[model samples]
Target: MTRPLPYFEVSQRLSIKEKVGQLFMPAAFINDSEEEVLRLEKLISEHHIGSICFFHSRASAATNFEGKKEVIHNKNSFGRLKELIKRYRAAAKYPLLIAIDAEWGLAMRIENTPQYPYAITLGAMQNQAELVFEVGKQIGLDCRKAGIHWNLSPVVDINLNPENPVIGYRSFGDDKKQVIEYARAYIEGMYSMDVLNSIKHFPGHGDTAVDSHLGLPTIEKSEPELLQNELYPFTELMKKNIDSVMVGHLAVPALSHGKAESASVSKAIITDFLREKLGWSGLIISDALNMHAVSKKFDRKGTVECAAFEAGNDVLCFADHVEEGIRNILEKGKTAQIEKSFERLWKLKERALSSELVDGHLQQDEELMQNLAKESLSLLKGTFSELEEFRNNGFEYLQIGKQNGLFSELLSNRTNNGPNTLLGIFPKQVKPKDNFGLTDTELQLIGQTLKEKNTVLYLFGNPFVLNLIDWQQAKTVVVAYQDFRSFQENAANHFMGKIEAKGKLPVTLKS
Candidate 1:
C-alpha cells in the first residue's frame, strides 16, 4: 500500500489551471435551486474548486443591501445545509474546506440552531473568559455538526465609532485589550473543538461610518494610530497562533502609502503589512469579494479576483464568477502565486477535514446563555429597589418601539392607569442612523411618559440608543444588551430582584 503525498507535493503535481482552480472559494447557497446546486457541483468536479462558504441564500447574503429580492425563510435550512455539504463533498476530488459566518452560532445563517449572545453582550460581563470560551466551543460544535470546517467568526475589530453602520453590535467593544482577551479565549475554545476560526475585518472596520456592503469605507487614520488601536487586537492574537485572519474591504490610506485601494486587494496591506510588518504567516482569507466595496470597483469578470490573489489572499472567498476568476489567474501567469496559496489552503483543509462532528450541548449552551444574561445586564440608572417600588405600586407599562414577546409576558399584569410607568424601549434597528430606528412618535411617547410619571426604564437593544432620548428622567434604567429570550427573562428576574445587575456598560454611552 502507498501513502498519499503531502499537500505541498500534491500542489507540485497539479497543473497551472488546477492550481488556479484551487484558489477560488465560491459561495454555496443551501436554499438555492437544483440547478444552482448542480452548478456548484460542476465547479467542484470540472473546475476543481478549493472550498465553499455557505450562506442561507443569495438574497439573504450581506451584499443584498438593495432588498430587491424577497427572502423566504426555509425552516429545513439546517438539514438542507447538511445534505448539500454531503453532496458537495462527494463531488470534490480533494476534501473541501467548508466555512460559514456563524459568529453568534448556526443561528447567524440557519433558522433553527442554538444562538449565542453577540460579542458586545459578552463584553459586558466582567471576568468571564471561561464563559466566552464556552460560547466559542458551543458555536464550534454547531458548525462541526452542520458539516462546516471553518467558522468565519469572532469579529475582533475594536468598535471605536458609535455610528459605525456595519460593525456596531457585532464588535466586542471599543477597548483593544478586552477584544484581544476575549478573542484569544474564543479561538482557544475553537481549537479545543478542532474547529477552524478566523478573526475578521482586518486592520479594523470598527471606526468607519460607511457600510462596505453598500459602498467603500475608507479609514483615514495614520499608520501609528491604526497600529496602536485598530490593529492592536489582531497583533496580539497573531502572537497566540490563530488559524486565519480575514482581510476587510475598507481602505487605509496610511497603509496603502496614501492610495485608497481596498485592503482585500492591496498587496501593501495583505502582504507588506499583515505578513511582513506583522510577521503573520497564517492563512489570510479575503472578506466576501461580492461586497460592493471591491465588487463595484472592477468592471471585468475576474479583475477583482486576480487582484485579490496578487494581493496575497490564500483563499478568494465568495468570488462572484469562479470560472472567469480561474481563467484570468491562468491567463495572467499567476501559477507561482496560485501554487503558494493552494499549498497553504490544502494545509488548512488537512486540519479542517480531520475533525469529527461533535454532539449538541443544548443544556450547557442554555446555562451559558443564562449566566451571560445575568452577568451582562447593566444597571445604568436608579436602584433595584426603585424598580421594586414601581412594581409594588402597580406600574403602567409602555413599550416605546418594537415589542419583544418574552419581555412583554412578564409585564402583562401591570395596569394601564397606574401612577408609575415601566417603559420598555426596543429599538427597531441596531445601527445608529435615523436615531437607531426610533420614530418621532416613539420619542414623543417616551418623553411624555417619563416626564409625567415616575418611570422605570428597560432598554433592550443597542446601548447607544440611550443617547437618542432623555433617559435621565426615568427613575430606574436597566440596559439589557440584547432582545434575546435569555436576556429578557434575566432582565425580568433582575426587575423583581431575583438576580442582581452585575454588568458594567461595555461601550461608553453619551448622555
Candidate 2:
C-alpha cells in the first residue's frame, strides 16, 4: 500500500489554471435532479473550482410552505451532500474542499441538526472558552460528518456598537481580550478535529451601524485605534496559526490611501497591513463577492476579478460569474499574479487535506449536547422565585421567534405543558425597506396578551428585534441569544429552575 502524498507537494505541482480555479468558490444549489448534479460535476471537473459554500435554504428538503408536502428533513440534505461530494471527488483533479457558513452548527444552515446558542451567548457564558470549544467541536463534528472541510465562522469581530445591523449576535463580545480568549479556544477546537475555521470581517465589522451586505460600511477609527480594538482578535488568532481570515467590504478611510475604497479591495489593508504588518500568511478570502459592497462598485465581472486579485485576496468567494472571473484574470495576462494566488490557495487546501477530518460518531454525544445547552442559557435580569411565581400565577407566556426549528419547538415544549399559557410569535422584516411594521391588530393582541400573562419569554432570533417590542409589562423576561433549539431549551430550563443561568447579557436590551 502506498502512503498518501503530503498536501504541500500536491499543491506545489498544481498548474496555474488549476490554482486560479481554486480561488473561485461559488454558491451552488443541489437538488434531487440529475441535471443539477451533472452541472456541479462539470464545475469541478472542467473549472477546477476549489470550494462550495452551502446555504440552508438552498439545501433544505422541499417543504410545503402553502399546501404541498415539501422536503422538510435532513435525509435529503445528507443524501444530496453525499452525492455532491461523490461527484465532486470523482470529477476533480484533486479533492475539492467543501465549506459552509455553519456558525452555530449544521442547523444554522441546514434543517434537523441541533441548534446551539449564537456566538454572543457563548461569549456571555462565564466559561466562554469552554463554551466556544464545545461549539467548535460540535460544529466540526457535524461538518466532517457531512463531508464539509471548512466552516466560515467564529466571527472574531468585537461588537463595539450596539447599533451594528450585522455582527451583533454573531460576534463574541465587545472586549478585545474576551474575544481573543473565546475565539482562540473555538479555532483550536475546530482545528483539533480537522475542520478548517475562518475568522471574519477584518479589520472589524463590529463598529459599523450599516450592514455591509446591503452597502459599504465605513470604519472611522484610526489605524492605532483599529489595531487596539478591531484587529485584536485577528492578531491573536493569527498568532495561533488560524486557518483563514475573511476580508469584509468595510470602507476604512484611515486604512486606505484614499477615502472611498472598501477593505476587501484595499491593497493597503489586505497586503500592507494584514499581510505585512500583522504577519499573517494564512489564506485571505473575500466576503461574498455578490454583496452590494463589492458588486455595486464594480459591475463588470472581469474588472471585479482583477481588482480582488490585485488587492491580494486568495479566494473570490460567491462570485456572480466565477468562470468569467477566472477567464478575465487569465486573459488579461496576469498569469503570474494568478500563480501567486493559487500558491496560497492550494497551500491552504493541502493543509485542509492533511488535517484530521472531524469524527462523525461524536454527533451522538447526547449528554455533551445537553450540558452545552445547559451552560449556554442566559439569565439576563430575573430570579427563579419570579419565574416560579409567574408560572404559579397563571401568567401567559409568549415566545417570539423567527422560524420553525428546534429552538421554537423547545420553547413550546417547556412552556406549553406548564400552567402558563404559551403563545409563539413570528415576525418578518424585509431588509433595505426598513419597514418593520406590525399590524394594529397584532400589536393590540400582543399588548393584551402580555397584560394577561404572568411572564413573557422573548427568545430573540436576533437582538435587534428587541427594539420592536415593549417588554415593560412582563413579570420575567429572558433573552436567549439566538433562536437555536438548544438556546431555547436551555433558556426554558433556566427559567424553570432546572438549571442555573450563568450567561450575562453580551448585548444591551431596552426595557
Candidate 3:
C-alpha cells in the first residue's frame, strides 16, 4: 500500500487542481471493472481527489443473477474492498482515506462480513455498555482489516420519532443520556482499536418523518429545543473530542434562520451553529451529496461543492461530480479555504491512519457475537418456562418476519414435530416505510393458527410489530427485536430452555 504524504508537503507542493481535488471525496465501489478503475485513476492521479467513501455499487447487470434484485448484496465484500483500496491508493497523490457508513458494522454494506446487532439491540443491552464497547472495538478491527480508516457510525441521534424512517433502528434509543452513554462507550471502544469515527446526521436526524435519502427532511425546532433534544448528542460528542461529525441533509428552518436549505449546505447551520457556537474544531463531513435532498437543488455543475465549501464543510463526501466540483471550487477562490480544511483532515489522517491496519483486539469472534445476540434476545410477552408446556401441546409456530429464510430453515428439520404442528411464516419485506403492522394474509394466518392449536407468535421485526396483532390472542409471544439469523437462533434457544431470554425491550411499545 502507498503511504500517506506528509500533510504540509502534500498541501504545499500540490498544484491548484490537486489542491481543489484534495477537498473532494467521491463515492467508490468495490466491484468496479478495469475500465472503471481507469476512470477512478484519472480522478485520483489527475484531479487529485482526497478520499473515497465505500458504498455497494448498483452498477452490475440485474440479470447478473437472472432475477429482479432490489439490493446489490455483493459477496466477498471485504476482500474486494481491500483490493479496491490498494488500487485507489496506488494511484493517489496522497494515500486515500478509505471510509464507509459502517453504522452497525461492515455488514451494513458488505455481505460476508462480520455483523453486530443493530443499534436498537445494543440499546436493549443498556446495562451492558461494556459489551457495546467490546463490539465497537471489534468493528474497528474489522474496518482495519479491510483498510478502512473512518467509520461514519455510532449514530447518536435520539430516536424519539417512531415515524422516523431512516434513524429508528439505527439510533441507540430515545433517551438523550442513554444515547450519549452508549455512543461514548462505542467511541471509546473504536478508539482502542485505532479506528476513527464520526458522530452522524448532525443537529440530529431523529425526529424527521421522511428519509433524507429520498428527500429533504425538515426539523422545526428553536435553538433551545434543539440544544435539549436534537443537538444534545453532538454537544456530548464534541466534549469527548470527537474526530469527525457528519452533517445530514436536513432542513432546520430555525437553525438556518428560517431558510429551507438543508444542514449540509447551510452556513447558518454548519458555520454559525456547529463551528462557532458549539466550537467543533474537527472535520465536518457533509452527508453524501448525491442524496435527492441536496442534489435536486444543486443539479448544475459544481453547485453542491460551491455551497458546501462556502457553508464550511471540511470534506465533501460522495459528491455528484468531482471534476466539475473541483473546478468550480477553484474558480470560486476557495483554494485559500482548502489549506485549513486539508490541515484538519491531515491532522485526523495522521492520528487515525498512522499505524499499520492491525489491532489484535476481538477479531470477529463468533462466541462474542452469539453472546451479544443472546444478550439482546427479548422475550417480551412470554416466559421461557411457558415454552415447555406449549411445545408439549404440539403448538403451531407463527413467525412474522421480513423473509421466509431463517425461521423456515429452522422449521424444516424440527425434531419434535407432531400432527398439530402447523407452521406459518409470513415473508414481509420490512424497510423504514413498510407497514409495521400485520398484513391481511398474516392476520388470517394468525387467526387460523390461533383457532387450530396453541399458536406461538414469534415476531422478528420492530417492537412496534406487536401492535399489528392482539398479542394477547396468542398462547405465547416472542419478540426478538430483530430478525438476524443469530438472533432468531438465540431466541429459539431461549424458548427451548437452552438460554435465558436476557434482553428487555429497549423502546416503549405502542398500546
Best by lDDT: 1
Q: Report the lDDT tens digits of candidate 1 across residue range 1-511.
A: 1122478678668777877887789999878999999989998999888889898888878888468898868877788888999899889876677889988888888887778888888888888899899988888877877878899978999978877888988988987888988888888887888889899999899999899987889989998899999999989888875888999999999999899999999999999999999999889999999999999999999899989988999899999888888887788746667777877787877777665665543333667888989989999898867777777878767787786677878757656567887788889977776888899888988888888889889998888888777888889889998888888999888887888999988887663
- Candidate 3 regions with alpha-carbon error over 4 angstroms: 59-74, 333-336, 359-363, 384-389, 400-430, 436-440, 447-454
Candidate 2 lDDT (Cα, 0 to 1): 0.70
Which stretch of 10 consecutive residues in model 2 shows the poorest summed lDDT?
Answer: 57-66
Clash count list over all predictions:
0, 12, 0
Candidate 1: regions farther than 4 A off: 1-5, 359-364, 414-416, 433-437
lDDT of 2 at 99: 83
In the order shown, the candidates' Cα RMSDs to the true structure are 2.3, 4.7, 3.7
User: Candidate 3, residues 122-205: lDDT per residue as tens digits?
Assistant: 887748888889888888888888888889888999887777777888888888888899899899889988888899899899
lDDT of 2 by residue, 1-511 (tens): 1122465676568777777788888775544367766776787788888787776443341121224435434446666665676677677776677888888777666655656666776777665577578778877878887778888888999887767776777887777788888888888888777888899989899888877776788988788898888987888778775778999988998888756788898889899988988888878998877777777888776677667877888888776676777787777636776766777766666667775544343244556556655665665545778777765555344443345555444444444355555444544531212423445566567677667755455544454555555656665556654544555567656655677776666665544
Arrange candidates, best TM-score first: 1, 3, 2
The TM-score leader among the candidates is: 1
- Sum up the clashes in candidate 3: 0
Ranking by lDDT: 1, 3, 2
What TM-score would each prediction reach against the true structure?
0.95, 0.84, 0.89
